[model samples]
Target: MSEQSSQGDDDPGEPLRLSVIVPVWQEAATIQATLQHLASIREAGHQVIVVDGGSDDGTPQLAEPRCDRVLSSGGRGRACQMNAGAEVATGNVLLFLHADTRLPGSTLAALKRFHTSRNAWGRFNVRLSGKRPLFRVIEWFMNRRSWLTGIATGDQALFVRRPVFEALRGFREIPLMEDVELSARLRLVSRPFCVTDPVVTDSRRWEQQGAWRTIFLMWRLRWRYWRGESPESLANAYRSDVRNAQEP
Candidate 1:
């Protein structure tokens, strides 16, 4: 590495060895609370990175104080936003968390502990935030199935060694299914750990779309992908539903 590159690599300071990178787009509604939650779990050598994907809703400003740095990336998709965050992250490990998700402080500690002991990357149990029985059923089944099968999603908050992540060339900069695509790639190297602690994800999408419709579409998408169909089609369906559901 050149001198300038070496200096840049060595100068991130000690407080940012493990960083939590949150990607946001129009998430002004929950960014502060999310950062506040992250800050409450203060640990040395940990930093929070908020990569705002051109949000016009003031989400970036809301994330400013609680995070170490806020970058404005010109991406209209999660894959690009998160990849941008990873590009600027100074940590040895990266945790890709969604803005609508919340993890208990203990789980963050568990991730660091697991990263240290097993010499493996990480994932978390997935729990949905809502009283819908379908949410409970899906969350439980998915968590247990992941435990048995090692499949994971971005909503579960994937963690990995910085070099391993970079070596894989990072997440595919697709419009959707980035998590599933990345998970499929990660499976080639090692099985993802299903942490006992879970990350709670908001379920406003389920509320907007009927539970059965949402679940059916998700299953159809998964089944299609598993049947060797291209994931891009399923991703397009998912984004369509998401856009329609989020609209007034």
Candidate 2:
């Protein structure tokens, strides 16, 4: 995984073809809608791949007809599933999308701009799907922080050139913070192309756990991660916190 490789020098004059990779696990209720929302991208000749993490909820069945390909990851974990999707991706650029996130109409145009730029990777600004003023503030901070730090989260709809992604060997197979870890590595290779067009991500987690509490928990987890805590431990704590929040 040599970051110095000249793979990013691929001909910029060539048209950019995007491959949207969505990793899912037991998302039967929302998978169809997510795939349907990408209809325009597919119609534009871009490829869509759904990698299911052994979803027994028939997510694969529903996604198969809507996308270009549906692959079974044979296990869970977004890092692994997304890596699997990237393995079969045929486009020059790969965009990792969340099952609950919706890209704006200007997504393709933004991607085209990124392809012509010097950047090898990028992410879209994110907007949470909640009407509350607090959600607006949260999204503003998220977008701003990412712009300043060059680190992106999965919810932001991360995209990268296929060669750059392969050079980095995809994401680390960690229990948590995989996106953060990958962003840190990518920043060393090249500054991220921050697109202003926002991707609307579902605010279900914040709404379910109480926005304030979720904010506090996430900040605490990130602080610990920056302090060199193990991802496995952080993942356990996150799961415990979420379970407690769900308790009646």
Top TM-score hit: 2
lDDT per residue for candidate 1 within 81-130, as digits (tens), equals 78888998888878899988998657655654555443346688878899
Q: lDDT for every model? A: 0.76, 0.92
Q: Largest lDDT belongs to which candidate?
A: 2
Cα displacement (Å) at residue 142, model 1: 1.4
For candidate 2, write residues 1-248 as lDDT tens digits.
01111234545477999999999999999999999899999999999999999989899999999999999988899999999999999999999999999999888977877787778798888999999999999999998899889899999999999999999999999989999999999999888887777899999999999999999999999999999999999999999999999999
Question: lDDT of model 2 at residue 171?
Answer: 93
TM-score of each: 0.86, 0.95
lDDT over C-alpha atoms for residue 189 of model 2: 86
